[model samples]
Target chain A: MSEFVEQLALCVERGKVNRESLYPPDLHGQDGTDELAKQALEQGLKPDTILEGCILGMDRIGAKFSENKAFVPELLMAAKAMTAAMTHLKPFFQSGAVKRKGTFVIGTVAGDLHDIGKNLVAMVVEGGGFEVIDLGTNVTTAKFLASIEEHPGCSVGMSALLTTTMVNMEGTIKAIKEKYPETLVLVGGAPVTKQYADKIGADGYSPDPQGAVAILNKKVA
Target chain B: MTSFERLQNRMVGNPVDRPPNFDIMMQFATRHIDKPLRDYYLDHRVLVQANMAMLNDFQLDIVQAISDPYREAFDLGLEVSFPEQSLPISTSPLLREPSDLARLTTVDPVNGRRMHDRLEAIRLFREKVGGCTPIMGWVEGALAEAADLRGVSTLMLDLFERPDWVIELLEFCCEQAILFARAQMAAGADIIGLGDAVASQVSPAWYRLYALPYERRIFQAVKNSGGIARLHICGDTTLILHEMATSGADIVDIDWMVDYQKAAEISDNDGPAICGNFDPVKIMLQGSPEQVREAVINCLSIGGDKNLSAAGCEIPINTPYSNLHAQTAALSEYYSMA
Candidate 1:
């Protein structure tokens, strides 16, 4: 059972989607997350155990990505493999056999339509076993407020790629904080920094999606 | 010395009156001067005035005519969303399938709305400056233009799922970029700036296989058309700096995450001037004038004496005017002593 969990975790880390998937060159034709995860489940592994394995794999990949040992392409592949395995476990989650730690609300701020950064964060956060509420790009402060209201205790993350729309982050941050002071808000993007995050009263800032997951994990923990 | 001479000297690896302080000006800044975004990007006069404001107000060395990445993508018939006071975005990607390439038409730079607008901006700048300051004409790099045509997510998938299709699309983008480069050169642009912000997202292997060839083609196109090429790939490009330098561009614009010294060592030459490596938000938007100056000094030291210019990525529109002033002041102070 422990060996199956370890293999599932390694599959997620290396991004092996299925037995036939040829990605990661070295892992070509090997049993992927799909087979390993199903085996784990058929062997009576709990849903929580499967989720814990995923979290462990994603945490490792995210940290490696943040430190520059891994790039976006690698992370995307890992996320894809993780998603394939998670699909099998979805039934368990839907039946209330397993519960996600918390919800995360995220979007690129208004006037900024870029979504790659936001999407990456959403994917990594979701792989970390959190319920992600993606608002898409060009999201206004009102939209974010509504999302926060819907999720209640959920944390929010705002992204901006353009220099112009980064200013709008400040307004969105202010509105969310004013309406829900207890709700945590994280900020990031190409033009964002820790200083700007602090200046705008955002609770956290991460340079990459892995950092964002780390911050979210810490907040939830 | 005149700004033109100062820029020329800096570009050629010589000491100048000061380091060249430049920014890839955005249409969002036009709101500060009360011009609508669409009108500013369309009208050469409005674009020039906005860029002039950036130079005059901030002492920028080169006044750029970069409005957004949509111009080339738009000409290729990609659906785009235009918003007020923000860059226009590609709404629907142009390429839906690999076979769709046969139906796509190449846009002549002189005939298209956005490309023509950019060309006119360069022409007007040449007429206005005429050796007073260097004017930069803009083009989208192949991968970035391809992403605009195929949607970023789809393109990333295409790299692995359909490598041949990615190559075909990139070829089209490169051919169009060469044509665009020629038109800007004809319009008297001293330097052609290629914006490929999306290239940073790919792995170095994919970059070497897909992006590098097209970059080399575009760089050669600019040089053959009698203009210098300045390649700007926004984001963390540290992994591919060695591959990037071999593309033969005259200048490379480093984003905030790449270290200047590393880029210099990888380029293995002094004349391929590097423009940036500062965090636009931390040092330009949020930092004090003193901090901005310190950042500039750090960039200069890391870049060494070989014709290094100063800028973070694109300067933030809301960056304090004093922060910019301090940047230029530091350049002048450093150069004067050198």
Candidate 2:
């Protein structure tokens, strides 16, 4: 509702990080998410309100990406802009002034060293307002289970770019559901599909980062 | 008909005994010979041995030197590590900063360790089955090599942030690919497979500006060397299929997500041969032999005579032997009846 919050949302949606950053040429030399979020907070706006604006921006870019109106560059820039704004809100989050929706544990399954897809999903999910525990690439079943144990009730997401590593998703998902039956497990990658996801007994599968956010949000809701 | 004759006839739209199978097998071939993936990627003898086994066992028409994307990057001085039975990893990117492009230098394919290994694979294939089957040698497309050196996420941002620097890097990568392709051709490769997998992640406009020109250059070099050029970009490439058709390649691999009918319709009537549309995981690794046969027939029907029977990408290492057999078997059965 506030002008500063709205401006911050535009900066994130358009990927304008700061006045010094020259991307999105249309927003050149203007105050970006870094300044606008600071301004929004200084003016007494709630951290939650600012976070809502950030998530709104991410949602817009994600929608555009899914429709082919945007691509990885646009999404990465938006995530970067969101990250810039989130820095000012970190203190609030630390002091119990801001609360996250939930935790999402994600990784590229074992035997798959590719992390681009896994990283993108982590960024988008974090931008969608969740505490993301990124386990990095080549994450084995034990690491995933340990993370789940540490972050109880956290939704699990696995990615594998190679078809060879995709089979690892099955073993990891089976191990997780057997131990944490109620925890939602999602899988995705270049080779992963809804059919493969279902065959592996995964709770959900997404083809894009934005879709991954939507799935996590729906389950959390 | 000889495998080479079958492929040549299919390329010219001539009737063949059956569609020539062009399945990309990397890890699958490695597992076939009971060799570690590390050996398959590093040793030409191991790669050639595995491929020869594929030719003998599956009646594969093409023997390929595609092990991983890191071959050129590793030779380019990137610190790439090879696991015993896993894909290579490059944790520390060579170009951590845009200015780091200055430090990058081109390596001669003959002298470069990994690139030379691929050429050796082609030479061995020529020695073993020179006149019988086609031998495909691979090089990373300019954009893909750039991503390998600069990291995918960082290079993606560089496309927007440092356009000039990205162009410089692309030009350097393109030159290396052209030289590598020409060297492979001279080493006895019948076809050169250029993989620009990163192009699928960018917008069509960026692809045209940053990736397409370089791909055209590399493919043109392959053609100049009397080698058939094949373009393979992984993922849903429907958005850029029209542009890809004009990239000077003889064959353009269509990933499973792109509709076979749509890809066929987009290419020029005299365009590159279209090869694939089957899901490697669903139809080959997970599906029964019956499903594999059905998918092969369906793709052939949609892709018409210009189609090559193959999976969308590499055959998964664990795909059931029966399902792998079903693809070529389907073609033989259907075409025999026809």
Model 1: per-residue Cα lDDT over B1-338, one tens digit each? 87878777777667777777766656435855778887776677888888888777767777678877888878878887666555676666678877888999899989998898899899889988867888888889999998888888778866765778788889999999999989998998988988888788877888888889999999898898878888889888989888887888878888878877788775445447777877777788788999988888888878765545556576676778788778888888887767
Docking quality of model 1: it rates as: medium
Model 2 residue pairs with clashes? none
Q: Per-residue CA lDDT of candidate 2, range A1-221, in tens?
A: 76665777788989999988989898889988888888777988888887988888888888899899999989999999999999999998889888888999999999888888898899889889998899998899999999999999899999999887888899999999899999999999988889889989999999998988888889879
When just chain B is superposed on the true chain B, each candidate scores a TM-score of: 0.95, 0.99
Worst 10 residues of 2 chain A by lDDT: A1-10
Supply candidate 1's per-residue lDDT for A4. 64
Q: Candidate 2 lDDT, tens digit per residue, B191-278? A: 9999999899899999899999999999999998899999999988999999999999889999998988999875447888999989
- List, for all models, the DockQ compared with the true complex: 0.53, 0.81
For each candidate, give its TM-score against the true structure.
0.92, 0.97
Task: For residue B196, give model 1's deviation from the true position in Å.
Answer: 1.8
lDDT of 1 at A17: 85
Every candidate's lDDT: 0.82, 0.90
| Candidate that scores best on TM-score | 2
